[model samples]
Target: MPKTKKLPLNSLEWHQHPKLTTLLSGDCHQLSTLPDLQFISFAQLQSILDSCPIPVVKRAKVDAYYLLAPMPILKQLLGHPDSHKLTASLNIYSEPEPTLSTLALIKPALFYQKYKRLPEILHSRLDKAKSMNLVTPNKNQISQLAQISPSAFRKITHSQGGSHG
Candidate 1:
C-alpha cells in the first residue's frame, strides 16, 4: 500500500458543471479532474448538499470550496409536479419538502406560473402543504371556486403549457 498526502482545506478545489451555477456558492471551478461532475447530476448533488449536516459543510468549505447549481434548476425542481413529496423510491429521492417549501415561500406565485395549472398544482400538494403546517386550498376546491370543469380546467392548463416536465 502507498501513503497519499492530503491537501489542506484552502488548497482543495471544487469543480462545477459548465451548465449550472450555484445560487449561494457560485465559485465552483470549472476544472476537469474532479469526479463528482461525471457521476452526479446537478439536481442530485444539490439534494445531497441540502440534506448534509452542518458540520460536514463547514469542513468542506475550509478548502477552496465551490458548489455549482443555478436558480433555474432550483426553480424547475421546485416546480416539479411532485416537488412537495420527499420520499424516495428505488434509491432515488425527491427534493426535500423543506427545500421545495423554501423556494415556494421565496416566490409564492412562481410555481403557479411555472406549472400553469395553479389549482391542480395546489390540489396535488394539499396534504403536503398541511403536513408542512402551511395553508392551502383542498383538492378540487380551487376548481369549484373557479367554476371550471375538469375538462375545461385541463384545456386551460394545457393551453398554458400545463406541465413543464
Candidate 2:
C-alpha cells in the first residue's frame, strides 16, 4: 500500500462548525494534496493533541474555540416563552465558562448577534436580533427546536462563496 504524505509546517488548522463535532481540523499530512483546511470534533480533538502519539500539533495555538452550553438547556431557552426565562437560562450558562452549548441554548437571533451576525441583516448579529425583551417564546418555537443537540453539527467548508477548502 502507498503511504500518505505529510503537511508542511504551520499547516495544521481547525475551527468550530455549526454541525458535526464542535471543531473541525485538518493536519498538514492531510493538507498537501487536499484543500488547506483541517477539521475535527473540538473535545475529541483537544484530547488527541493533549496526548498525541505522533505529536501532530506543534506550536499549537487555539485559533478559534467556543464555550458551549448543554443542548437541553439551550432547548429549554429556545422553547421558553418568557424573556425572564430566557434571561434566567442565559445566566445559568453565563456563569463560569460559556460553552457553545450555552450559546446553542439561545435562539438563533441572539446567538447570531453575540457571534457578530448583525440583527438587521438577513443573519444579523445577536446584538441586532429582534428584541428578545419584547418577544416571548411560543409553542411553535419550542416545537421547532425539539430535536437539536447543543453542539456544532458540521463545519461548512468552502472557498469564497463556493465549495469548502
Candidate 3:
C-alpha cells in the first residue's frame, strides 16, 4: 500500500461537488469503497453517504471508506482532461484513488492534446520544494550517480526506451 494518512473519512473536496442535491435525491451513494473493500465487512455500512449543506457536519460512524477513483470522471470534473495530467495526478497523490478498468473511461475532451504539460507539473513540484529550501543536492558524489534507481520499474521499462527525466 502507498504511504497515506487517515483523514476524517470526509471528502478532501468537501466544498464543491458531484452535486449533493442529485446525490441525495438518489437513495444510494453512487460509489462504495474499492473492490478490496469487499474484504471488509460492509454489512453494517450504509448503502450511501449522507449529504448536508451545513459547513460543518458531525462525523458519522464510518463503516467503510470511500475513495474518489482517480479515473476519467474525476479528471473531467477537475477540468484536467489530458491523460498525462490524469496519470500524473494519480501518481503524485499521497493516496491516489484506485483505478478501475471497466468503469474508468476518460471522456472525449482533453485539457491538452499532448503531455507537454507533464514537465510543467513536475517543474512546479520542484519549484515548490526549492522555495521551501527542501532540496540539497550532493554535488560531488551521490548526485553524480545515475538518476534512475534500480528497481522493478527501471528494469521493466528500461529496455523499452523509457528514461527518467
Candidate 4:
C-alpha cells in the first residue's frame, strides 16, 4: 500500500482531510457540497438538546415551539412545509440576552421527523447562551402575540420580500 502525506489544517483542501471528512460524513448527512452544509441526525440533535438547553418558546394554540435559527435555515424550513410543520418570523419576543435573529415555529413531531442539523455557528451560539444561563426551562415560554399562524406569518414574510435584518 502507498502512504499519503497528511495536509496541514490551514491548507485550502482542508475539507478533504481524512479526519474532517470522516467526522462530517460519519454523523451528519450532507445537504450541499458548495457551502458544505450537513444536517446531524435527529438522535444526535436530541442528545445535544438533553445537555445544552435550546430555549423553546411554546405556542399553545398551534402546539408548536419557536426556536431560534439562522435566516438561511429558516428560509429552507419555511419552503418545505410537507417535510416539516414550520413557520418562521423575523419578529420575536424581546430578549435581553442571546439577541434574537430568526425564529422557526415548528411542531415537535414534524421537527423531529425532518430534523436538519443546525450549523456549527448556531450550535456555538447555543452553547454560549447555555453557559451564560440565558436559556432556562422556565423562560421557554413566549407571549400569545408571538404565536402567529403559519400561513399568516408566511404571507408577511413573503410580502416583505423575505429579507429581515
Candidate 5:
C-alpha cells in the first residue's frame, strides 16, 4: 500500500477538491465527508468563496434570504470574527428549487430574494472584518498566504469588485 499526502487545509486546491465538487454536484452527504473547518481563516474562506459561486435563494414561506454553500464552507464562515451576526443550518428540500446542504442567514436580513444580488459591501465586510482572534490562521495558512504573490492577492480581492467598505 502507498501513502498519499493529505492536502493542507489552507491550500487553494480545496476549491476543486473532490468533496466540494461532489457537494456542488448535489451530494449532500459529501458535506460530512469534508475535513473539519473550525480553524479555517477568513482569508481562506474568501479564497473558496472566490472560486465557488454559492447562490443566495429565498425559501417559500420564508421572509429571509439564505446563502447556500457546501457545509464545510459554511463552517468556515461560522468561524469568522463577525459570525455572531450570522446563522447557519442544514437545508433539506425537494421542491421549488432542490438544495440539500448548508443555508446561512445574513443578520439584519436581506429583504430581496434575488440570485447573487447580495450587496457588495456585505461581502467586503465579511472579508475585511478585523480578525478578533476568532479563528487563528494556522501555520499552513500563514505559509500559504506568504506564498501568494501580492498581485495574486490583489486579483483575488478585486475580482468581486471595488471594496465598498
Candidate 6:
C-alpha cells in the first residue's frame, strides 16, 4: 500500500488583513467549520475583506465620523509635519457650542491607519466624571459638555499654544 503525502499549509494571507482579524476574532463560532485559513495574496485577502460586512463598512467609513476626539490632540497631529498632509479639517470646533472645544470625531481604525499610534479616546473617562457629577473646571464641566478629558483637550492646545489656527 502507498502512503499518503501530507498537504501543505493554507495560504499565509489570512492573518495580514485587519478586517479578517477583526471578523475572526469577533465571531469564532461561525468560523468553527472553516477547514483552514489560507489566502493566496494581499489582493485575495482584500477581496475577502471587501466582501465581509464589517470590513466593508470599516473601510468605507474610514473617513466617516464615528466619534469625537479632543481638540488639542487633533491639532497636535494636524500640525506635525509628518501627520499634517495626511489629514486636515481638524478645525471642527463650534464657537457657539459652549465652553469645551472639540474636533470632529475620527474612528480608531482611521487613527491607527494614519498615525500608527492608538489615540486615547476620553469618552469613557468623561463618562466616569459625569456619573460622579463632579463639577470642576477641568473634569465634570468638559466631560459633561464634550465627553472628553482635559488632558486630551490640552493635547491640541499644547501643540498650537492655544491658537486654533
Best by lDDT: 5
| Model 5: ten consecutive residues of lowest lDDT | 1-10
**Could you tell me every candidate's TM-score relative to the true structure?**
0.20, 0.16, 0.19, 0.20, 0.26, 0.15
TM-score pick, better of 2 and 4: 4
lDDT accuracy of residue 74 in candidate 5: 52
Backbone clashes, each candidate: 3, 42, 0, 0, 0, 6
- CA deviation > 4 Å runs, candidate 6: 1-62, 69-71, 84-165
Clashing pairs in 3: none
- What lDDT does candidate 4 reach at residue 14? 9
C-alpha lDDT values of all predictions: 0.37, 0.27, 0.28, 0.29, 0.38, 0.29
Estimate, for each residue in 22-125, the C-alpha lDDT of model 1 and write its tens digit.
33345545433211122334455346435531111112344432222222232333334434442211111132333433433554455556655654554445
Tens digits of lDDT, candidate 2, 37-93: 122233423343334211111123642222232222322222223312211111112
> Candidates sorted by lDDT, descending order?
5, 1, 4, 6, 3, 2
Candidate 3: tens digits of C-alpha lDDT, residues 25-91: 4444344322212221222122111111112221223322223222223322233222222211111
Question: Model 3 — TM-score against the truth?
Answer: 0.19
Instruction: Specify the poorest-scoring 10-residue window by lDDT in model 3.
Output: 44-53
Per-residue alpha-carbon lDDT of model 5 for 1-165, expressed as tens digits? 111222222321222223325545644432233344546555655566545443434444433333333334555554566445433232222221333233222411343333232334333333454354444454444334334322223212456553342
What C-alpha RMSD separates each model from the true structure?
16.8, 20.9, 17.5, 22.2, 15.1, 22.8
lDDT of 4 by residue, 1-165 (tens): 111222111221101223223333544443441221124333432343344333333334332334333223333322332324221222223341242222222333355433232222233444456799874322112111123222222212233332221
**At residue 98, what lDDT does model 5 achieve?**
33
Best by the TM-score measure: 5
lDDT of 1 at 114: 63
List the candidate 2 regions with Cα displacement exceeding 4 Å: 1-12, 17-97, 107-165
Clashing pairs in 4: none
Prediction 1 TM-score vs. true: 0.20
Clashing residue pairs in candidate 6, if any? 11-38, 67-105, 68-105, 72-155, 72-156, 73-156
